[model samples]
Structures are given as structure tokens and as C-alpha cells.
Target: MEKVKESEAIEIDIPLETSLKKKLQQTPRWETFEPFALSRVPYIIRENNKELYEPKVVSIGPYHRGKESLRAMEEHKPRCLIDFLGRNPEIQIEVYVEEVKKLEARARRCYCETINLNTNEFVEMLLLDGCFILDLFFKVRAREPHTLLDVGWGAKTIIADLLLLENQIPFFVVEKLHAIVTHYEGDRDSLLYLLQPSSVSPDLPAKGNIYHLLHLYYQWFVPGRTSKQRSRRYSGILISTEHSRSNPIVSWLNSRSSRSNKKPYKPMRAIPCATELREAGVIFKRKESPSDVFDITFENGVMEIPMLPIDSIRRIIYMNFAAFERSNSAMEHDLMSYVALMDSLINSNRDVIILQQCGIINNMLLNEEELAVFFNQLGDWSTLDSDKHYFAWLFAEVELYCDSRWHKYRAKLMRDYFNNPWSALSVIAAVILLIFAAVQAVYSMYPYVHH
Candidate 1:
């Protein structure tokens, strides 16, 4: 029998093809799609320390709105609402609800995930959460005591929860609710004033530009230098891609020769730890009244770093800030850069002690080892671009200072001979004895010559 001819190849499924085409057409274009400001902490970062990302006591946004563990704080939200409403008695509850309802779509778009709550539910959630936050701010500003917020550890936990990457509603929602409730006519004073501490200027980003509470908090720590200035500073260091790739052998040879010829003043992948740097004659000092925590500087063998107080709550706050920067590419990695710098400087307990003695670190951890571990682990959460980060110049200067051979010799001499008064005295005595012996030998030679 003739080999059975295979049935004609199956024709493409017209309906299925059409369906797929429709799906492809509906899919968002990656080039044009903007990222949501509020998103889950990336798994790469969250896996390192899940507790830092999760809200322990309260949930503000739709992501963690109904969790069983966070529900205990839900009942307290209504109490906050009552307190908020009591602040502005003339404005009815419906006015606030209506305002938030208008903001529902915009607020939902701020979150990366699709919100499951309906219009009514979403509006009410926004109302309660926004009012709760504003009430806390009011309480904090007035220095008034709240039954829950004033209770032991409650304020700290709630503040951390509010700053969580997952637990945030859009700031505009809160701002709108505030305006409706308070009828404040001032341009900058109402919400911005309340959110920031007295020390931070209320002159923040324009109202429409702010994403959420965490974003606002992130803005407060931004380095005084503008991005344009940073770009200018890094402009000279950028090698032309065409020139680098023009000749492989020549490029390799040039790189080798450059390495051999230079004094190694380049940026380091990881700078020496505090102890090692100290041994290299690098002095550490606490930057007094720094503009912000990121204001670190190095000059003439001295590194002035702002004081960093490490505690459980502050660690969580900073970690969340780092996580936010990691997730949102639009944000500058100021906090992450700072963390990376700290991680490089603190490699062990001895390094911690060095920073502590210089008043650079006020570690509240059980031991110096724990603080060191915290920084080391945090460094793993985000990869820093040393050449492009805020601390790039500072790092380069520090490495250049450490690379000085004279500084090393001087440091060695001080450590070996002048480390203590006894050592210094012995050194002085030995030098004097050698000088006397040389003088006596010269006199004896003179007598022989005269004879």
C-alpha cells in the first residue's frame, strides 16, 4: 500500500488567531507605559527581609487593607475618622466622601495592582485611611496625646506601617480630603506642613507630583545637588563607547598601562572598612548639623560623615525607603547609595567601634556586630552604581586619600613609635643616644687627623 499521505496540514485556527490578535492589540505598550508609583517591594529585595516590607500594625492602601493580622487597627480607623470630622464640624461626612470618590480612579492608578474594591468601598477606604493619617499628623503637630498613637510603641509601629511600600494611598487623595475637611486656602501650609517635621521645609514637590507618603518622605532626604549638577560632575569620566570598542587589543593594553601608571585614585568597588581606613591615616569625623543624612564629604585625609542612629524602627524605615528606590526607577538612589557607602565602611565590629568613637554611628543594636550585619545585609538588597551615585565624588576622594604612600608611612610611624607616651619616650631616648655616639666618634676621628 502506498504510504498513507498525512492529512493536509491543519489550517490556522481563524478564531483563535483573531482572539490572539485582539489580545496583542489590547496589551499595553512597554515603551509608553508609565510605572505605577505604588508597587509591591520587589521579591529580590523583600526576600532578604520580609518583615521590613510587611506592615505589622496597620494597612493604609488596598494592598493590605483586609489582612487578618492588620485588622485590629481597622476598628481604630473609624475612631480616627470621628476625631478628623470633629476637627471640622461644619463640613459633613458626605462632602469628604464625595471628594475622595472623585479621586478614586486617580488614586487606584497610583497603585500597580488592580484594586478589588468597588466605588463605594474604595471611596470609604480612602476616606477612613486619609482621615486617619491626617489625624495622626494633627496629633503629632499639636503635641497632643492620642489614646492609641500615644500608647507605648504604637506610634512607632504605625509610622513604619504608613511608610511601607505596599501600604500607601495616593497623597492627592489625602490632600483632597484635607482640603474638603479643613477648607484651607493656603497654597503650601495645609498638608505639606503637617506631613513634614518642623525641621524640614514644607516647600515640597508640587501637590500633583507627589505619589504617596513614602514618596514625600523620600523627597526629604534628597541631596541638595540637582541631577543636572550630578550629570555634569560625571560627564568627564564617561568613556566614548565607540573609542573603547574600536580596538580590543589596544584597549586592553591601554587599560593595563593606565592601571600601572595611575595612583589608584579611581572609585573602588568596595572601599576599605573603617578600621582599615583609619590604619591608612584616614580620619573619621561626624559632620555637624548636616543638611541631610546623605551629606557625606571627604577632604585631605578626613571623611566627615553625618551621624547615623541605627534602631529597629529606623532600620525598617530606611529599608523601606531603599526598597522604594529599588522598585521605582524614577527615584534617585540617595538612600541606597548611602547604605552602600555605609556597608563598605562597616565590615566588622571593629569598623563599627571606629565609627562609634568618631560619633558617626549611634548604634542602638544589641552589639556592634549586629549593626554591622544589618548594614552588610542591606548592601545586598541594592546594587549601587558607584560612578553614578550621589556619593561617587566622595568615594573617589576617600580612595585617593587612602592610596597615598606617605600617609601610610606616617600612620605606621605613629602607630608603632608614637602610639603611647612610653613608646614615644623610648623612641626619643634611642635617637638621642645614637646622636651622642655619632658626635663622640667624630671627635675621636678629629684627634687622629690632628696627630
Candidate 2:
């Protein structure tokens, strides 16, 4: 190529290899990539709920991995790497680096960002982050709590930190590291079980590819039972996102509503609080061995619902789960829908009090008002059309159960007539006296007619 200099024309030769490499790597700025592993919470959602979106204590991936505040935890990464390598002394340090180097391209493609990191930097990050996670899991599984992990806000903070969307490494990298550590089949299966102590091991998402720990956690709770659409009644509204697939930013709502051939939806309504329904003679019972936390049923006069725990940890988990689901255009916002349903039922402290009495809400936070507010505010994190929500049918059923004329009348009877012994006795005496008076009148009328 020839270029004109300030004084004269200059001729320079470009290398074919370098030129080809530059051309091959060049991508259109407008072209967006589909998320293969992880993504940042969309600004639309994160802006409103910043605390819910950001990690507080520990950072995992390259995004938040190297902050001044997070440096305290960063020191543990090398120590973990050393410990992990010590376990498998036969495998050299260079081997792990090479293995991760092979995965560096695929991993770079996983994140939504265009990583500025070269191959060496990215591989180093993966190795360090992956080792920290592996060591943490190994220590937890072995019941050998590391001194740092057991100190103030240690384990609890790490659990929350690991579940952060931005703080995730590729599951494949973790699996590869795990395999390198444990060579035998029986031993390897145990580690997998240890990784998800809270969930059924058999169901962990293929070699299952997950976006991150939060995604994996969301999948962990999916019911093993094959029961689909448990409620016969669906209310509030039936809908799905009506968007053309060609658009990259497709709405997360279901597209079933667009199919003209599909059957029309039945009417459904939101349910009342536990106390209001109880007044209507509806009994609330805790579900036994239910597959899903949101699994609820209204049959005859009984409303059986699984208990939901309300606390800081649960709220954090749920918020991340909803964010993760919302980030992926293909997945449904099941967590958001469930939280919305609960939030709708709780208007104030009274509603929370009622649910607590019925064993409907664990109320672990021990503050009814706070729990209700937490659930209510969760809707702001992400929005899902109520009609297309997963629990629409359950809401309709509860509304139907509460609206029963017979139940309302029975509730009134219980409240007014059989409220207490004194009320019952007063009614009984009034009826007896009225009967006697009627008999006396009848006798008098009979004598007059006979005369």
C-alpha cells in the first residue's frame, strides 16, 4: 500500500497473515450475538432494581472480577488454584492452562460483551475463577469448612455471590476441572451430587449446559412430576407476546396467543387473601410433598398451597432467577409470575397475618409488612403479562372458591349464629319462646272456631 507522507509518498508492505487475521475477526457493529452462557442484566430492568442486579461481596467472572473492593476475595483465588492443583499433582499447571486455552474462543463467545482480553488473559481468568469455585464446592462437599468461608457473613455471602448472574464462569470449565481432579466414575458422580446439594442430582442441567449458577438453580426447582397446567380454571388474562421472530429483541411472553387455530381461553380471576377466603369457609392446608413451591390447589372447600419462605436469601435467589429468566427471550418468567400472584394476595399487613396463621407463608423474615412489601416490589424488577402467567388458572380457581354463594352464606352463619356459646344460646332461646307463643295462638284460634 502507498500512503502520502507530509514530505513525500511512502510505500509499505502489509503481511498476508496479519491482514487475513484482522479481516476474519472483523464483525459488523450492528450484528448482535445470541447468548450462549451469560449476559448482563438489561439496563431496562437493572436500572430500576440495581441492588438486586449487582453483587455485594464477591466477584467471579471478568466483568466484576477485579475491583478494588472485591480484591479481598480475589486473594483466595490463587490459594484455591494451588489447593486444586495439589489434589491432582500428576496434572501439571501447564496442562490446565492448555485445556482452558482450547476453550477460550468458545468461552469468549458465551458472554454478551466483546471481551478485549487476549487468549492468555481470558484463560488465566477462567483457570483462577474455575479453581475458586471447584475448591469451594470440594470443601463444602467434604464438610471441611475453610477458615475464611466460616467467618462472619462468609458462607452466606458466598452463596449469594455465586448465584449472581454477572459472577458466573462456564459450567463446562468447572466440569472439566472437576474431571481432572477426580479420575474415577463413582467418585466423579459424588462431586456432581455435592455441587447441587439442594437439588436432585439426576436432574442437573447435559454435561446439561446452563448459563450460570442462577440458571442452574432455576432449573433445579422444576418439578419432577409430569403434571402440566394443573388448574382447570384460568383467569386474570390469557396472553402471549405477539412479536415477529425476525426481530432480535423478541418479547419474552409466549407466542401461543398468535395462533388463530388455538382454542379461546377460559375466564379467570385473581384470588383473595387467606383470611378473606377463610371467612368464606375455605380451609387452608399446607401441601405435602408438592413438587413446586408455587403448586396450589382449591378443591371442594379446601385451598391447599405449598409454603413459601420469605427472607433476604430467598428474595435474592428469586430476584436473580427472575432476572436470568427475563434475560433469555426464550424462557418464561415463572418466578416473576409466582411472586406476582403472592403479591396480589397481600395488600397489607392483615393479609400477611392471615397467610401466616394459615401456614401459607413461612414468614421467616418475621415481619409481615416487609414480606408483603418485598413481594409487591418484586413486580418492578420485571414485568410479565398477568394473563400469560403460569398461575393464572390457580388464581381463577381460588376466585371461584371464594365466590361460592353457599360458602359465603355458611361463613355468615358461622360468624353471626355460631360465633360463640352466648350467641348460640340467645338464638336457641328466641326460637323456643317464639315456638311456644305460636302454639298458644294456635290453641286460642282453634277454640274460637269450634265455638
Model 2: residues >4 Å from true position, as ranges?
A: 1-25, 28-37, 184-191, 199-208, 224-269, 381-388, 419-421, 428-451
Q: Candidate 1, 427: how far from true, in Å?
A: 1.2
Candidate 1 clashes: the total is: 0
Q: Write the per-residue lDDT of candidate 2 for residues 206-285, one digit (tens) a residue.
A: 24446566666677764422334332423333322221122211121123224535343343435676667778887777
The lowest-lDDT stretch of 10 consecutive residues in candidate 2 is 244-253
Question: Highest TM-score, which number?
Answer: 1
**What TM-score should be assigned to candidate 1?**
0.84
Which residue window of length 10 is worst by lDDT in model 1?
A: 227-236
lDDT (Cα, 0-100) at 380 in candidate 1: 68
The TM-scores, one per candidate, come to 0.84, 0.78
